[model samples]
Target: MNQHIQPPTSTASSRIYDILRKDLVGGRFAAGEKLAINALKEQYQVGLSPLREALNKLAAYGLLIQENQRGFRVPRLSRAELDDIAQMRLALEGMAFEQAIVHGDAAWEAELLAAEHRLKCADMTLDKDDEWERLHTQFHRTLVAPCGSVWLLRFIEQLHDQFDRYRRLGPKMPVIRQELDQQHHELVELAMQRDAQAARTLLDDHIRKSYDVALQCFLEHSG
Candidate 1:
């Protein structure tokens, strides 16, 4: 079994990167917590070089902060940062949604609705976090799949990842599943109706509401 292991610099770094990225996003490691090298080596079962490489890659993805001499730490949560991400997401995703509605074909429409349905049916309890996250991300991605700009999709994806981290790190949300499901239905209906302005407005509020929940949750937890 040991004979199959790849060298530390090559395969090991990729493996460590995947685990660390998931851990960071899933809030396994607390935000702003320093990543000690010796501790990580024991936990992840990797050499120093591979661990550093993995951490640096996460830093590039905005999931970690790497400082000189201080080493790596998870990005800290802040109300100001959450507001900034929401603003950016509103503008970028609104533009994408408009373009997608214009450029999307019938198949895209079908897939978009399908993704929404899957999300509605998803098991989003705390125990099924990874599965819930994947479905949620897919549903949102389907909304903008026909924007026809690779760069735009990439940027939005990165923002969504960061924003999602904030959501997960916060305490349990105030919005229950039924209300959320209704909002999702409304969004899909508006998109299907080609009501770009209404849909964008809904999306903006949809995002802001989540941010508000995150803010409230954070404040409550802090208190």
Candidate 2:
């Protein structure tokens, strides 16, 4: 595992932040699980200060919640949270897609197609490999890149980071994740055709279905 991980070329704090954030998103710890500083120090081979720096950063990202004296824990997940995120994605990303269709140039179209292709060709089992997460993010971001709203794009990316932890811990497994490839491909297709109604419908269904599956997974495991 260590062999594949790139050695930190930046500050030790930066490396710790990157690695810890990935683990949080990867479900290395369950939601709301306590983050033990002593254990983490031994796990990542880092000093106390740098570890604290990393923890503080993750808390800033909302991946971890920090308590006054309790330190940090992975952010808790809930059905209500999922619903809110789904609706926000539907509103924000839906608008981005509509705007993209209106203003999308040939370059935007090409990037969207390319993003879809990369996702298809990559193994994107959400629970398995981290590369899949990067590709998945790229594909979604590319779809809305022509929307001309920087703030919207930033919000979309932040929401995706929040959404990822749930997906990683979900029980739908690799097979169900593979099935999402079709939805992704069709989203690109509808975007290319500039069919806003069809595209938004599909996008809404896509995000909602994903949340539904993840919610079920959480319930099953939590029970």
Candidate 3:
């Protein structure tokens, strides 16, 4: 006899939280925009309790800020914070690249090649899809998959997520895609050849360029 499997029930609070989080990170709820609970409840068709819970959860993630006596709003992206994050990302991701280069074997190389192919295919569209973003993220993750340190990879993943909020703004910037595609191709070449130093340098430059452009655009628009 075959056993029946059950799908897990989706919780309203988590669903509401995810929707708001996506909108916030996708730059839909622009920085410092007020997030009224009543409005969200009406918009999501949920009650006040779930809405409050969702907002509180997002506050913990630094995406939303709660003001005493006021309410929640999208946190403003500050240049200082962006720079600090970029510095941390450089250190972590650079180390990961080094480890992957030194330790990755044939299987890892094959996986990297497959991921690169998927990324190239998904990136063909000018209108970026969430699916393409997912595949792109997987490609980067696979590039560093040979690194043995779980803690370091976890930290790097968190930083990547934080940087993603700013990355959503990338499409609006002219020439960003062409520059990114070139950098990615170079990175893949260096990695495949086991040139750790060149890969690390390219990775660092790639991370910083996007951060610099995004920070400048954000500042100009906000100012």
Candidate 4:
């Protein structure tokens, strides 16, 4: 019989934290799944302390719930809560897009163009590389990076993360990709022309459309 040896690596707490975060955001953990600390410690080859720390971090991010004597589990999404999140995203992202149009300079325009080019080269297929998803996110972030409001960006990022799991689940929808690309093109074009009103309208519509699709998918799947 041959014995297997594992490689030594980074701090258990950080490693556990990163892995859990990725899995939570990717929907691999699934919503409302119980997170048993002992099982996690065994799976990650870590101790209870590191597993607890990782769970605490996830709870802080609203991705997990730490109940009294019940341990941790994935957070549940209610329809009302989802609607609130969507509305907030629309308001914040719409404002950011408008401000970017007003405040963005030539350098911002250049960056936006470069980002768009990178996004265009991204593989949008269902089996696309994870790197493409990362770049796609960066390109969208770059579009509104000139907004100059830290709180606004923070809120938008939170909404983006919450929405991303559903987005990934429905990537194979043709209408999703077609509408997304069309909206991105229009947004970039309007921003380049510094048309604040048109850009904001497009941005609002783009965000709302995705929210609607995600909500529909979420409901269907949950049912």
Inter-residue clash pairs, candidate 4: none
Which of the two, 2 or 3, has more lDDT? 2
lDDT of 2: 0.81
After the best TM-score superposition of candidate 1, give how far the Cα of residue 125 lies from its true spot, in angstroms: 5.8
Clashing pairs in 2: none
Compared with the true structure, the alpha-carbon lDDT of candidate 4 equals 0.77
Off by over 4 Å in 4: 1-16, 45-47, 123-129
Flag the better candidate by TM-score, 1 or 3: 1
Clashes (candidate 4): 0
Q: On residues 1-223, what C-alpha lDDT tens digit does candidate 2 reach at each position?
A: 6887755533899988989887887788888788889999999999888888888878887888988654898878887787777789889989988898889999998898888888887854444466777788888888888889999998987787777777767775555566676899989889889898899888888887777667775687668
Task: Tell how far residue 9 is off in model 2, in angstroms.
Answer: 10
Top candidate on TM-score is 1
TM-score of every prediction relative to native: 0.86, 0.85, 0.81, 0.84
Ranking by lDDT: 1, 2, 3, 4
Query: Which regions of candidate 3 fall more than 4 Å away from where they truly are?
Result: 1-10, 47-50, 68-70
Tell me the whole-model lDDT of each prediction, alpha carbons only. Answer: 0.82, 0.81, 0.80, 0.77
**Candidate order, TM-score descending:** 1, 2, 4, 3
lDDT (C-alpha) at residue 211 in model 4:
77
Instruction: Report lDDT (Cα) of residue 153, candidate 4.
Output: 87
RMSD for each of the candidates = 3.7, 5.4, 3.9, 6.0
Error of 4 at 121 (Å): 1.2
> What is the C-alpha lDDT profile of model 1 across 1-223, one tens digit per residue?
7778866587889999988887787778877788899999999889988888888888999999988754888887777887888899999998999889888889998998899888877744434468777888898899988999999999999898888777776655545434555687788898899988898888888887777656764575456
Clashing pairs in 1: none
